[model samples]
Target: MRDRGPLFGETVLFTGTPKSPEVFNLVKQYGGTPISLPLIQVAEIEEADDERKMNECSHFDWLIFTSQSAVEAFRAKMLRFGFSADLIHSKIAAVGTKTAAALEKIGFNVSFIPTVFSADTFVKQFQPETNRQLNVLFLRGNLAGSLIKEELPFHVVEWTVYKTEKQLSSIGKILNILDEATSVNILFASPSAVHIFAEAIAASRGWEGFTICAIGHVTEQALIEAGAPRVDVKPETYTLIDLVNALARRKEGL
Candidate 1:
């Protein structure tokens, strides 16, 4: 099974924020020496600033959740203020199955989940009505994609519930590991992670023996734009598990 795992004995680094430990364990389960150097930190936005907008959630016809982070962050902050969870009575649209599952865990019914996981695909499937205007309340992070807002002619009211910040605590040590690792496979969960990791290792030739794995086209584009010459792993499903499995398949080929 370890041989089938394909990433056996490989040193793979994870840059998934707020969920790094779980991902680290997954890498090990697949027989890789998992490294966790968090490149991003997920934090809830100021409650005082977002409170009014969050309380006004009942005005929308559609409640959109783009990521699990947004769902978690919103619940944590809003529940602390004794905010009613019943504000989400509108039809719900989740970008991916994970997000839909997260919403379901919170006891919200998911009305739609796109076949494809990207924002572009989700946007394409949604048909906007000019006559019967719809108000969509988008709960998202600071670095969220604007394709939903750009493509749909809905009255979109977005609340930035969370943010991603750089978590580069020990850059020198991380760089050393990057240089010394025999066959490094860096996994990026978001565009910010790819951008930060790429910038931090730009001057070092440490990436010569490394493989860059991006979760989606957005993150893959970030890696390419940051000059990552070899983005060897990109999954079509665009989930963390899918990304890891794709890496396993790539290693099997090698």
Candidate 2:
């Protein structure tokens, strides 16, 4: 595959939900083998208490959405509670373009969106002094990072809209791919993905021969903390397209 180009014959293993097809196609287009090993399974919380928590979401000052799953979960809960889209009077802040687009699709205009997508950068860019005592309501998954809540100086309400768990059954598929491929590039999108990948690798006696690539600093840190060595940490970018483009550029340079 190196005969075709830098990444012509490389196999890239993707973990997490198959949310973005664009990134997968781009890897294949560059002559790289794209493998999917979905480690985190996402499902809506259907408990009565979960329904009750979403009902009180309208009382906050701002509704912050971090992922597309959070937006979808919030929308489903709103619909179940018989609340219209306008029931949320609080302004909306989305972390990335995808989350903002999801809110817009549901008839809500995102008031604030950070140029950088990570929680740390979002907090740095947030002007809490200007909007002092802002009561921000965060809609997120069960395994979400506490960076936003810990850093914000104002009141922050965290509403758990979804949950992520590791799928051990996916270990077989990942091991099969690793056994067949000449070289593999593990692409980690989140800290949870990093943890799950590490668990899977440990179960399969490690992917020591493969190259591990993390989307951002948080994921890279997770990989290191999990005892994975030589991780390729990328610059901060919200989209997987940027990650793939950066990989292509690196391959060209090599």
Candidate 3:
């Protein structure tokens, strides 16, 4: 929180989902003016994806959750299907502490939780030695790429439990930031949010002056691939608090 005091009175534009409010608070603690307008909306996958969720979820030896939205989407869909104990298997693995906390909130005893918050780290540390082909269930969103399957060697059964829809804020808000802030720092948590912004305004419209602060390695890569400007700073710890700290550090080099 005390990294050279460079973030005093800076504006930080948060681009994460609605589940993120602590990020705004963290920005304030780091002495940055936080502006949060969700650029992506999370919703349960309708129709065919629901059927796929029910079909693939029942037989997995390990159920892996990558995000809190995935956790909520899977739980809500199970409740709708009248699933008592059939929703998840006895074994569960969460990608990070936040995701594990989301599962704990719903009373699911998480058998495995990763120390690091990255999918690459989770795949490195948590893959158990299996002599036979292990069936793994990946509960994720429409925008979540096939990273899990590429990282895990087990037989994967993926379910698109949720969908992230892109949204461009009213031009008034964008203009207000342009008028009010000295420098705009757009914060990105997920690659989906980056892609959403690219689809709407990032690549196709005017965003030449905003500084991008990505949460982690994957997100930084996503921001680059989406044709967004080069990231001004990226947190090594890959958390919102650390990202805010990194934003403060960005001022040191200016």
Across 164-200, the per-residue lDDT of candidate 1 in tens digits comes to 8888784665688776877788888888887777677
lDDT of 3 by residue, 14-42 (tens): 77875667877776766778887667778
- Candidate 2 ranges beyond 4 A from true positions: 1-6, 49-52, 128-132
**RMSD after Cα superposition, model 3:** 3.2
Q: In candidate 2, what are the lDDT values of residues 1-254, reduced to their tens digit? A: 25575578888888877776888899988888887887888877677686567667777878889888898888888788777767768888998888898899888978888878878878888773463577889988999889889998879988888888887788788888778888777788888877777766754576487777777777778888988866763755757777777777777776
Candidate 1, residue 111: lDDT = 83
Q: What is the lDDT of residue 47 in candidate 2?
A: 77
Worst 10 residues of 2 by lDDT: 125-134
Where does candidate 1 stray beyond 4 Å? 1-4, 18-22, 47-49, 128-131
Worst 10 residues of 3 by lDDT: 166-175
Estimate the TM-score for candidate 2. 0.89
lDDT of each: 0.79, 0.79, 0.77
Clashing pairs in 3: none
